[model samples]
Target chain A: MGSPAGTGTGTGLINGMMGRNNIFWHECAVGRGDRQRLLKQKGCVVWITGLSGSGKSTLACTLDHELHSRGKLTYVLDGDNLRHGLNRDLGFSAHDRTENIRRVGEVAKLFADAGLICIASLISPYRRDRDSCRAILPDASFIEVFLNMPLEVCESRDPKGLYKLARAGKIKGFTGIDDPYEPPLNCEIEIKQEEGACPSPSAMAGQVVSYLEEKGFLED
Target chain B: MGSPAGTGTGTGLINGMMGRNNIFWHECAVGRGDRQRLLKQKGCVVWITGLSGSGKSTLACTLDHELHSRGKLTYVLDGDNLRHGLNRDLGFSAHDRTENIRRVGEVAKLFADAGLICIASLISPYRRDRDSCRAILPDASFIEVFLNMPLEVCESRDPKGLYKLARAGKIKGFTGIDDPYEPPLNCEIEIKQEEGACPSPSAMAGQVVSYLEEKGFLED
Candidate 1:
C-alpha cells in the first residue's frame, strides 16, 4: 500500500490522536460541565442497596418522581428491569452477578457523565460489589442509600412471596435466606423502621431529596 | 416463611407489585416524556460509521459542540474509547466484536432513554450489527450517518498508523484491509469527499444538525 498521492488528502482530516496502546480518545469540546449547566443540575448516581422487598425499587421510583417534579432530569436503572434488556445475558451465578453489577456501574457512570441524576436500585447483597460501583463514580457523586430494614421485617412483608419460596427451598440463594446480605458500613442515607412502623414511600423519597438538595446536586 | 404475624406487617410496606414471570416492574411516575420536557429536547441516537480513518470521531465531536452551543445536551460514545472501559474483557474475535457492538448499542439506548442526544462513532463495518442497534431505539430516533470516504482516501490517511501495520501483516483482520467493510444501503445521512476534497468538520456536522433540527429531535 504505497499510495502517496491518496495519503496526502488523508493526513488533512483526522483530528483525534492515538493515546497509549493505540487507543484514540476523542477530545470533545462540550463536556460534563457544559451539559450540567444546560440541565441546571449536577450529575450523580444514587445507589440504593437492600434485600428483596426492602423498598429499593419503590424508593428509587419515588425519588425519581420527586426530582422530576422539581424540574430535574433523572433515570432509574433497576436491576430487575435491566435483566429484560442490557443484562439479559447474565445469570444468577456469582461470576455473572458481578459482571451484571460491573456493567450497570459503567452505564450509570455514562448517564452521570451525560448530566442526569441516575438512580440505581438493586438488591446488591454483597458489600464488595456495591463498593466497586461506588469506586467508579466521581467523589461525592455516589450517594449510597441503605434500606436498613431487618430481615424479619422484609421477610414478613414478602412483596413477591420470594421469602416463602426461599424458605420452602423452592428458591435457593435468595438474599436474607440462604444468601447473606452485607449491609453498608458507611452509607450516605439509611431508611429503617421507626417503632416497628416503616416510613411511607413519599417520606422515604423526601429524605433522599433533602440530602441531594443539601449536597448541591439539585443545582448546577 | 409461613409466619402470619410477620406477613401482616410486611404487607403494609410494599408499593410495587409483581408482573408476569414474577418480575417486579417498578412503575415510575417520571417517564421519558417528562424527561424530554425537562430537557426541552427529544432523545435520539446518531450512529456514525465508516472506515478507521474516515473522521467519524471528529464529526461526532463537532456535532456535539454545535448541539451544545444551541443549548442541547449530547454525549459521544467512541468505540475505541469504550474498549478501555466497559468492553475491556472483549478481544478482536468475530463473536467478541459482535458482543462489543451489542453492549454499546444497549448503552446508547440507555443514554437516549435518559433524554440526551447520543453520538456513537465506530467502524461498525457489519450491516447486521448496525441494524440491530436501530431496532432498539424509538421510531425515527436512530439516525445512522454513513461516512462514505473511499478506502483509498482512508488508507492514505492512516491516522492511527493502523493501516501501515496491517499492510505489513502485523495487524490482522483490519477493516478495509483484510476484513470487509460493508457500506450502508439505506443510511439517513451520507458524508463523502466533495470535488476530491473533504468537507470541513463544521460543514459535516451542520448537515447532521440540520437533519436533527428538521426531525424535531432538537426540541421536546
Candidate 2:
C-alpha cells in the first residue's frame, strides 16, 4: 500500500507522508498563478531588513499605504506586531532569533503565495537567516529591500527611545548595539539617505513601488 | 518618555509595547475594508473541521478552485501542507495539537486580513481549540464548516490508508480511532451524507459558495 498520508507515527513519518503527496497535492491544488490573476498583481515579499530603528517599520507602513492607495493588496508583517502573536513563544536567544526569522520568512512566503505583497520589517541582522528566507520564494519574487540608514541616523531618531535604552545597558543583544548588522551582499533593492537627511516616507515608498512596477510585480 | 518600541528587554516587554502600538497601528494602517474593496470581496475564514480522511482536503481544494474560477482570491491552509513548514516543529502530543490550532488560527486571521477567503482544512479533534480559533476572528467572519461524514465512510474510502494504520495501532492517538473527535457544537455550516452516499466535491463547494454569496462575502 502507498504510504499512509499523515499516519502520525511521529516526526519520523512526516517526511515520507509529505514527500508522497507533495507533487500530487500541488497538481490538484489551485496555484499561485490563479490567485495572482484574481488580484491582478504578482505576489511577492518585500523584506525590509536593517538595524532596529532604521526606518524599516516606517518604510513598511509607507509602502503599505502607497500600494493600498493604488488598489493593490498588501500586508505588513512587522516584527514588533508579530512578537505579540506568532513569535510570542520565542525569546531573543541566538537560537530563538534564528527560529523567529525562519517562522516570519515562512509566513511571508505564505502571504506571497496568497497573492498579497507581503512587507516584512525586521532587524534581521544575520545574513544567513535572511538568505534562507530568500531561498524559499521564486527567483526575483523575494525582493530584499535593504534600508541602508546609518546607525547614527536611527539612534538620533530613536522615535521610541530604544537606542537610549540600549545605550544605558537596559537592553542587551540589540542590533547595532551589541549585535552586528550584516549588510546584504546582493539585495534586489536598497533605500538609503540621499544626503545627510532621510528621504520623505512617500519618497521611500515610491522607490519600492517603482521597483515593484519595473519588476512586473505590480501586474499579474 | 514613550515606551521604547521593541526594546528587546525580553518577553516581559512585548505586552507593553504591543499595547502602546495597537490602536495606532490600526489607525494609520490600511484597513481591511480597503483590501476588500481592492479584491471586490470580503475577507473571511472558512474553517473546515472533521475526522481524518473525511474529505476535508477535497472540499478545500474544490472550494479554492470554485472561488478562483469566479475570480475570487482564496487560499487553503491544509493541515498537512502546514505541518511541512509552519508547524514542522510541532509533534502529535496533546499540547502540540493545541499549539497547532492556535498557530493556524493566527495565520488564517492574517490571510483574511489580506482580503482573501481563507479555507482552513484540519482534522481538529477538540472543541475548545476550534472555539478559540473562532474567538480570534471578527464575529461571523470565522465560518466553521463541519464535514459530518461518518467515520465508517471515511475509513472505507481510505484514500491514503491512514485509518488502516490507525486501526492497526501503527499510529497511536489517531482521531476517531484511539483518540476522540469532538464535533463542533455550533458550526456555521454542516455537510453530511445523504442516502448512504457522500456528496460530490463540486456539490460540497457549491454549498459553501452559496453561503458566502448570501453572507455578502463574494462582493465588497
Candidate 3:
C-alpha cells in the first residue's frame, strides 16, 4: 500500500508539511534592523553587585533617574523591591540565591532585548551565578559594576541593621558573614566607599551615564 | 533602681535608643506631596485587563507610546514580557495566577509611588484579585480599563490559537474555558470590541489619554 499524499515517509513527509521547507525565507520579512532603527539606541544590562548597605540600590535608582532625565529609556530592578514581589518565595539559602540571580539575569536579558537599559541591583555574591548571567547576554551588553566597599565599611553603615543581626547570629548565611562573597574577577566599574569621602549616589550615577555614552549606547 | 543615663523608660530613652526615630521623620519628609513636587507629576497606575488576544496589550502599548511621545514619564509592565523575567517561575495555575497579579500590582504601586504612570496589562480574570490591587493602591490612583470583548469574538480572533487549544482540550484550566472570567464590576473605562467595526487600538488609547487629561493628570 502507498503512503498518503500528505504523509509521505520521513523526509518526504517533513518537506510536504513545510511546503517550501526554506526556514531562512522568513528572515527577509522579519528583521531586528527595524526595531533597532526605531529605538535609535542600544540596550544593555548594568548588573550592580555589592554587599547589603554598600549603596547598590541607591546607585541604581540614581542612575535610572539620570538616564530617564536624559530622555533614555531605563528601568531599575532593586533587590528589596524585587524581593517584595518577584523573589518573594525565595529564601536566603545558597541554592535560592543562585536561582534568584539566574531569574534576574533572564529578566534583564528580556528588557535589553525590548530596547530598554535595565539596571539590576542585587547582592548576588556568587561569582558563578554572575558569570552565568554574563554568559546568557551578548558580549559588551553585560556591564558588571562592583560596589567594593570594605566589610568594615558596610558593617558600620548598616542602614537596615542587617549586618548587626548577622554578626549577632540572628541571620545565618548572610553574605560577608557566615557565607562567602566571591567578588567579580574583572568588573567593568568599581566604586569604593571611603569614610566621609564617599561620592553621592548621583556622582556615581554620572559615571554610569558617561560609560554608556563612551560605549556609544547613548547619543552625545 | 533608676535606669542609666539615656536608658530611662520614657520619651527621652526611646528617642535616644532609636536615634531620634528617623523613620517617622523621614516618612513625613518624603510625603506624597513632596514626591509629586519632586517628580513634577502626579503618580497613578493605569491597569488594563482582559482576556488573551483581547487588545489589552495593544491598547497599553499604544498608550505608552503616546504618553512617551508627549514627554510624560511612563512604563508598561506587559504580562508576557514580565512572565519571561520577573514572574518566570509562576505557572498558569490559579494560585500562580493570583501571585502573578499580586506581584504586578505591588510593582505598579511602587512605580506609581515613585511618580511615574505605571501601565500594567494582564488577563486579570478574577474580580477579587483586581479588588485586592485596588485596595493596595490609593483612591483615584487605580484606573482600571476593561477590554470588553465577547468570548465568542475573542475565540474567533484566536490570534494566538489559545482559545482553540483550550477548546480542543489541549490546554487545561484556560480562562473562559473550564475556568471563569469575571469582568470588572465598575471599571473606569470600557473598550467595546464590536464586530466588523472595532475601534483601532490607537483610538482606544486616545480615549485613555483624554480621560487622563480630563482628570488633570496630563496638561492639555
Candidate 4:
C-alpha cells in the first residue's frame, strides 16, 4: 500500500514537483539488462490451435507443467479462462475472435520479452488470424502446433457441449458448424490424433519440448 | 488432439458423445492426483506490494525461483507484464486500480484452488481494495508484505521513469503523485529501504519464505 499522509493538499503538490527532478536523474541508473541476465534463456510463444474438444488446452497445460518441472519458466493462456478476464469483453464472433487472438499474441510477445515461454491454447479457426499472430512475434518465436482433428471427431468428443449446442442452433457461428475452420497449412508441429491412437497429452507436449530443444530453446 | 474422422454428426449425437465421455473418464481414472493432494497445505497469498522503483518484481521472480527449486509449486502475477494482456484494457485510475486488484484476486484464488502458491506484486495503493481481496481468500491466506521506501528514495531510484512523467504531468493518475498511495495498516512483513543500508532483494524474499515455512506453507 502507500502513505496516506504523503497526500496532504500542499505537500502532495510539492512532492509532485520534486518527483519530476528526481526522475530525470534516476533513469540512467536502473535497467532491464540485469533482469535479462538472470533469465538466461530466450523466450517464445507456442500457440496451440484446434477445434473444441481437440485437446489444445490439455496439451498446453501439460507442456507448461513439464517445462515448470524441468526448471524452465513457462505459462499457459487457456481460451475459456482468458475469456473470464483479459478477453472478457470479446464474443465468439469472427471479429471478436480475431481481436482475441491479436490481444493474446501481443501479451505473449511481452511474456517472451520477459524471458518466459508463453503457451496459448485457442480454437483460432482462421488461418489469417493465426498468420497475423505469427507476424507479431519474431521469426521462429511463434511455434504453431495445430491439433488437426476431423469435425466429426470433435463433435463426438464435445467436451463442453459446444458441438451439441451449435448443432441445436443454440450456438450460432460455431467453428466447424455454421462457421469454418481453416486448418494451418504449415504448422511447426501437427498432432494427428487420428493417425494413431491419439498420443497422451504429455506425449503431445513432449513433441513441443522436442521442437524447443531442436531450436536451441531449451538448455541441454 | 482428436480423432481424424468417423462418428455421427447431428441426430446420433448421443452415440458420438460416448467417445468423449470415454476419453475424459479414462483420463480421470488414470490421472495422478498430485495437484489435488497439494492443496491440503496452509493456503494463502503472499501479496508483494511496493513502488515500481523498489525491488518487488525482482524479489517476486527470485522467490518463485527458490520455491520451485524446492518441491513447492508457485505462480507469479507481475504488474507490468500482466497489464500487457489480462489487464490491457484498464488504465491506472482509482476505479480501474480496484478492478485490477479484484481480477488478480480471482485468478490467485484459482491458482490456490489448483494447489499452487500465488505471489502477486503490484503497486496496489488502496487498502480497501487489498482488504477486499483478502476477504475473498481464506483466513490467514493473505500475507501482506509492504516494501516501505521513502518517496524521495523511490523517486531518486525511479527505475521506469514513471515518477518523472508523473511529476511533469505527462502521466495522469500516477500513484504517489496525482493519486495517493495508502500504505498497509498492519502488513505481515515490511521491507525498509534506508539511505545507507538495505537487505538484498533475495534476502528480503527469504524473509517471506521463512514466514511461509514457519506458517507451515512450505515443507520442512
Candidate 5:
C-alpha cells in the first residue's frame, strides 16, 4: 500500500499541500448571476400549494405559458407528473411524502439556481415542508401561492376522480379527506377561488403574474 | 361520505368531469424544445467522470466559462461542492456513493430536460451507475466525457488531499485508492490526459467543446 513514487509530496504533478480544507476549492464558477445575466431574467421558485383538485397543476401550466410567451424561461415541477418519473419510488406514507417534497424542493432550488423560473405545483399539505423549501431558496426568490379554495369546492371539482376514491375509503390518508392540509401562514399570494364563482385557470395565473409584476419580479 | 351534492359529478365548479384516465394530462406545456427554440441552442448533459484530482471540476468550470462566453446556457454540478449542500446527508460508503450518483443523475436529467447544457463533474467510479445516468436522458443528450487520467497521475495531482487521506487509511473507499474506478469502455468522449503531456484544463475543455460542436449539440 506504501507506494513511494506516489507518496512523495514534492514529486506531485499539481503539487498541492494536504490539509483537508486546504484543497484549492474552485468556488468562482458559473453561478445564478451568470445564468440570470445570460437569460436576462431573475430565477425564483413559485411554489403553488393547495388541496387535491384545487387546480394547482393547471394554474402552474397557465403561469408557465404566460411567462414563456413573454420570453421568460420557466419549468413546472408538478407533483402528480413527477410521481410518474423522479418521485416514482415514493408512496403516500408520511415519510415517503416528506422525502418526495424534499427531493422536489431540492430540484426546484437547482432549477432556480440555474436562473430559470421554476413553478412548483404540489399538494404540499404541510406547512413545515413548504417552509423548508422556502428556507433553501435565496431571499425574495420563494413565492408561495396558496390556492385558497374550500375543501368542499375541491371535492366538487375532483378532476382525477381521486376525491371519489378517498371518500369511498379506497385511497387512505388522502389530503383534506383522511389527512389534514396545513395552509401557508405567510404566503405571498392567495387566490380565493371559492370566494364566489371559480375563476378560470388563466385568470388565476394572470393574478399570480400580476403579483410578480407588482413585486418587480417580471421586470428586468 | 355519501354526499350526493359532491357525488353527482355534474355539480363540479370547474365543470370538467374527468374519467379516471380522461383528465387530459396537460402534456403540451412549455417543453424542452420550446425552451431550446427560445434560447437558440440545444440542451444536453456533459458528464465529466473520473477519479478524484483528475481535473474533472476544473474541466467542467473551464467548459462552463467557454460556453457562457459563447452565450450558451450552462451550469456545473460538481461533486464535492454539492456534497456540502444537496447531498450533505450522504457519505462515502459504497451504497451511499451509488445513491449520491443516482441523485446527481436525476438532477442532471432535470437540467437537460429544462433545455440547458448541464456539466456534471463527479468521480462516479462505477460503470453501471454512470450507465444508469445515461439511460435517463433523452436520445443523444448524455455526453459522457471520461477524463482518462492514470491513478498515479491523479494521485500526484491530488487537489483535495482526499487521495492523501485515502492513502494513509484516514478515509475509506476512496476511488482509485481503496476502491475501484471502472473506466468507460464505450464512452462518447474520452480525453486521454495521461498520454504524453497533460493538457491544461482550458485545453481539455476546448476538446470537449469541440466534440459537442461535432455532435451538433452546440448548434442552434
Candidate 6:
C-alpha cells in the first residue's frame, strides 16, 4: 500500500548502499539500519500465491493503496508484468518458472535491502519454489499470503479468459487444470475466498494491512 | 546522491503499478509520470565507465554523498558486486561480459522506471556495449560519463591490487591490458585525470550535479 516518506540522514543511505561499488569494499560504512531509520519504517516482502483469477493482483494493488495512505514505502512485483521485462527471457516451462521465481525473489531482496516493502504476486504453484524464495530473505522479512479459492470460482472469474483457453486444450500445463497448484502448508497468513471469509479486494487489502500493523512491520 | 523525499498521491501510484497482474493488460495503469512527480525529480541513468582503478567507485560514492545531501534520490550499481549475485552465472568470457552489461542495462532501466537516479559504474570496456545500453533507454535518460583516466594512472592507483595481478598474469583478458577498451566517441560528459581538468571526488561530483541542474534534469 503506502510508501513511508522521509528525509533520511546521509549516514543511513550510505549504510544502505555503500558497498554497491567495489572501491569501498575495505571500508566500514553505514547500513540497513540507517536506511530503515531514514525511511521511518522497516522493509519486507509480501508474497501472494493463488490461481490465475484469484484476485491476487487486485488485492496486492489495493494493499499498496492502503499502505501508501498510511505513509509506508511499497512496490509490487507482479509476476505477470515482470515477464514483460525482467523475466522476459524466461518461458513457462517448469525450469524456466523456477528461474522466474528465483530472479523475482532476488530482486525483492534487493528492494528490501534498500528499505522498501516489495509485494510479489505470483501463481507460484510449487512448494519448493516458494521455499526457495523464503530461504533467501532475512528472518521475518518474507510474509506468505495464501489466497485459498476453489478452482471453479477462479474459473468463473476467468479474469483473462486463461481458464477457458486451458479448458479448450489450447494451453497445456495450466496451473489449475493440467498443472497442479500446491497450496501452502504453513503460510504466515491465509485468506479464504469462500462464502463468509472472502471480502472485496479493498477489504482483503485492509485485512493484510492489519496483519502488517499488528506484527509491528509498520512501526517507525 | 540525495533521493527526493515524497508522499505521492494514491492516484498517481495506483496508475504506476495497478495492473501488475495479467487481468488489466487491456488498459494502462500507474506509470512513470506518477513516480517522477512523487519523487519531485526526474529519474535518469548516470553510466560511469573507466578502467578498473580509475576512481570510478570513489567518484560514484562521493557523488552519491553529494546528491543525498542535496535530497535527491540515487543508487549505484557497481559491476564487481553484481557479479557476486545477479550475474553470478556469468563469467569473464566475452559472451558473459556482454550478457552482464545487457542485464545491468535492463536493471538500470527498471530503476529509472521506478524514478530512482541510477548510477552504474562498470569497466564496460566496449563502446558497442555502452551504446546498446543507450539504445534501450528513453531519449535524454542515459547520461554517459566517461572517466578519461590514462592506463598508467589507473595502473598506479590499483586500489585492489588487481592491476598487479593482471601484470603478473594472475588474471586474463583484463581491460586496458590484454583486452581492448574502446573509449566512448561521444559521451555526454567526460572527466579527465589531468591536473587542470580532474578535481577532487567531491568537486567532480559538483561538476556533475551542476550539469544536471543546467540541463534541468534536477528541476523540481
Fraction of native contacts under 8 Å reproduced by each candidate: 0.64, 0.40, 0.06, 0.02, 0.30, 0.03
Error of 6 at A10 (Å): 18
By DockQ: ranked, best first: 1, 2, 5, 6, 4, 3
Tens-digit lDDT track of model 4 for A1-220: 1112333321112234332222211111111232234444457889999888888867877887787666575656666555544555566656778888887776566556545577888888899988988976766989999998777777888876878877887767778998888999999999876565778888898999999989977652
Q: For each predicted model, how many residue pairs clash, with residues at least 3 apart or on different chains?
A: 1, 0, 0, 3, 0, 29
Two-chain DockQ for model 4: 0.12
Candidate 3 lDDT over A1-220, as tens digits, reads: 1122353332121222121220010001112233234445676899999887788867886787777766565666655445544566776666777877886786676556545677888888989999999987777989999988888888988876767867887667778998888899998888875675777888888888888899987741
Q: DockQ for model 5?
A: 0.26
Score every model by TM-score: 0.90, 0.90, 0.72, 0.64, 0.87, 0.83
- What is model 6's DockQ versus the real complex? 0.15
Cα deviation at A148, candidate 6, in Å, is 1.8
Q: Candidate 2 chain B: worst 10 consecutive residues by lDDT?
A: B18-27
Q: Judging by DockQ, tell me the better candidate of 3 and 4.
A: 4
Badly placed stretches (over 4 Å) of model 2 are A1-14, A17-28, B1-14, B17-28
Off by over 4 Å in 4: A1-45, A57-76, A85-90, A93-96, A102-119, A132-141, A193-219, B1-45, B51-78, B81-88, B99-119, B132-142, B150-171, B193-206, B216-220
What are the runs in model 6 whose C-alpha is more than 4 Å off?
A: A1-30, A194-197, B1-29, B196-198
Q: What is the alpha-carbon interface RMSD for each candidate?
A: 8.9, 7.4, 14.0, 11.2, 10.0, 9.2
> Of the candidates shown, which would achieve the greatest DockQ relative to the real structure?
1
* Candidate 4 TM-score for chain A: 0.82
- Against the native complex, each candidate's DockQ, computed on alpha carbons, is 0.38, 0.37, 0.09, 0.12, 0.26, 0.15
Q: What TM-score is obtained for chain B in each of the predicted models?
A: 0.89, 0.89, 0.83, 0.79, 0.86, 0.86
Full-model lDDT for every candidate: 0.83, 0.81, 0.69, 0.66, 0.78, 0.73
Please report, as a residue range, the 10-residue window in candidate 6 chain A with the lowest summed lDDT. A19-28
Compose the digit string of candidate 2's lDDT tens values, residues A1-220. 0113554331133344432332113223677887787778999999999876688877888999999988888998877667666776888889988998998998998999888899998889999999999988877889999999999988988766777877887777778998899999999888898868788888989999999999899999
- Writing each residue's lDDT as its tens digit, candidate 6 over A4-79 gives 1241322112113212222223111324555566556787899999898887888887887777767666777877
Error of 4 at B69 (Å): 9.2
Task: Give the better candidate number (1 or 5) by lDDT.
Answer: 1
Second chain TM-score for model 4: 0.79
Task: State the lDDT at B20 in candidate 3.
Answer: 14
Q: What class would a CAPRI assessor give candidate 2's docking?
A: acceptable
